[model samples]
Target: MMVKPLATNRSSSGMSTGKLAVWWLIASEIVIFGGVLASYLMFRLGHPEWGAAASHTNTWAGALNTMVLLTSSLSAVLAHQAAEQGDGKKAARFLYFTVLGALMFLVIKSFEWTHEIGLGFTLQSGGFWSFYYLAAGIHAAHVIAGAIIMIWVAAYAKRNEELQRVEYIGIYWHFVDIVWIFLFPLLYIAK
Candidate 1:
């Protein structure tokens, strides 16, 4: 006898269980990220002198990462399209490209952080620097987590199993990219 999870077999909602679960997770993540960003905004507005610390952020590196994330999002879109057409291999291939973009973004972020740290921009440097590291560090953690999950999803997709997961991870990846769109301007351009 074979048994599957009850959620897999039952769907009272119009959405698939996988989709609903992903959305639920995303909603929780939104609450967390929203709180952090909102707090940072309040702090930034209260202390104009923090602009000095903001000036230290690497706009070029941020811009480059923005492009990488956006491009990776495009690959995610393509992966979803392939999965919809029942081409799991193609979907997995696109997912791999998307992961490559994630790795590239992380590498650039590391170099930028190394340079800033070398120049004495530690988390304790100032109020703005503190929020900068907190917000950006959280975002970077999400990027790393997303990439790891994406790799696992891609492995299943390559085997033509759990193809619908392609869309779920794409949703999460887009959210990650959108966060960067917000962070890039706030962290890199507000100076």
Candidate 2:
């Protein structure tokens, strides 16, 4: 017989245990990402010369990635809704779509980095380049992590098991997309 974990515990806050956990994690992540972006903004504001470096960044590529991530977030929402409706197969399909969007964002980002690096905009190039790579790289790492977890979650969702986890992963995926939304303008459009 399959054993069910304590997956049904609703907190006093009217949230599931799993959802509360995801929110707690997201709160912690906000601190981390907030620190990085705040620091970048401070530096960018103080150093006007950084605009030149920022201008070198490919805005079109950043915008494209932004669109991709937003679309992925929509798929994640659909996955959560499917899970809620007891449609595990549909949830898994939407989760796969979300993962595809994550991969596409990464691919576009990689090409953008390749082009920048080809033009000698290395991380060691200057302060602006350093912050650019650092912030974007951290966000990219999160994308990779979200994609991997999503694949695992999708597997169980396909089997109609742990349907609640679909919602949990969707929360995490949305957080990742939100981070990109902040990063895109700070690192790309601020020029």
Candidate 3:
């Protein structure tokens, strides 16, 4: 009887385990965000007062953050491309730039929050304010988490000659950007 070699390294299919895992994580994230978005829509329709309160949110700030996230996404893609080409150093550089963009987004958000809260528009101000802060805050947390992940990927790239993790990290980062795209128009652009 001949013994077969145990299946190892990537699945029998050849699909990277890292990429597959990221997709699963993204699918779960979609459900969580979908639920949040659905609840927001229902709340928006149920209460007319929210519209008036929503008017108080700074659209320009939100727009700036949108730009920041978009730029970071571009950097993340470039980073992943570099990694796939086995240029870990270049990938690390791009990842660091992406992190900078994320930090810029957070700083802008902090300023927006401070300005709004100082204007006596606290989360307790009204239904819209509550939802606005809640949604935006949750998204901001995701941004921070993505940035931290990027930092870890960057560190790995610096010390290693080749890293398959960069591409998966890029995928997750892009998903974060896509979520913000939907959120930007809904929370900031849409009156």
Candidate 4:
């Protein structure tokens, strides 16, 4: 009997493998972040006094980071557009801008955290501080991860190789931005 070949690489859902994989990854991330945020909300409602701690957060810093992430998202979109136009160098330059935004975000976050910690708002301070750190720390990790991936994608973008990956990275970067959108108000402005 002749051995049958594996099915076509395309999923039965009609989505390309890369796109489907990114969606799946995003879905999983949503569930994780959603659960965490929901838990934080429940705790927040129970402990209204936490607002005092939340108020200690630097609104300016959080707002600045929000703008940075939103701007970086625009860069990611432009990079994807450039890739579609077959302009690898342009795409790489835009990706570099996105990465720079990510760096700026982390730098600002580091300063904020340092200031907070120096003021005695640390992980062991209280529930509000703990949640604040937990949420922001996780988000920062995502930012770093996205920046690293963008660097890799930009390298290939410069070479005009794996152009499709540029779009995939864009999707992930946008999702990261959306997560921060949810987080900023919850952690910084809710008070």
Listed per model in order, the count of residue pairs whose N, CA or C atoms clash below 3 Å is 0, 0, 0, 0
Q: Estimate TM-scores for all models.
A: 0.97, 0.95, 0.92, 0.94
What's the lDDT for all of these models?
0.93, 0.94, 0.85, 0.92
Task: Judge candidate 1 against the unseen true structure and give its global Cα lDDT, from 0 to 1.
Answer: 0.93
List, residue by residue over 134-181, the lDDT tens digit for candidate 3: 888888898899889889989989876437888888998898889888
In candidate 2, what are the lDDT values of residues 25-76, reduced to their tens digit?
9999999999999999999999999999999999999999999999999999
What TM-score would you give candidate 3 relative to the actual structure? 0.92
Model 1, runs deviating above 4 Å: none
By the TM-score metric, which is better: model 1 or model 4? Answer: 1
lDDT of 1 by residue, 1-191 (tens): 97879897477998889889999998998999899889999999999998888888889999999999999999999999999999999999999999999999999989999999999999999888888899999999999999999999999999998999999999999999988999999999999
Best model per TM-score: 1
Local lDDT at 140 for model 3? 87
The candidate with the higher TM-score, 2 or 3, is 2
- The ten-residue window of minimal lDDT in model 4 covers 2-11
| Candidate 4 per-residue lDDT over residues 68-187, each given as its tens digit | 999999999999999999999999999999999999999999999999999999999999998889888888899999999999999999999878889999999999999999999999
* Model 3, C-alpha of 100: deviation from truth (Å): 0.1
Residue pairs with backbone overlap in model 4: none
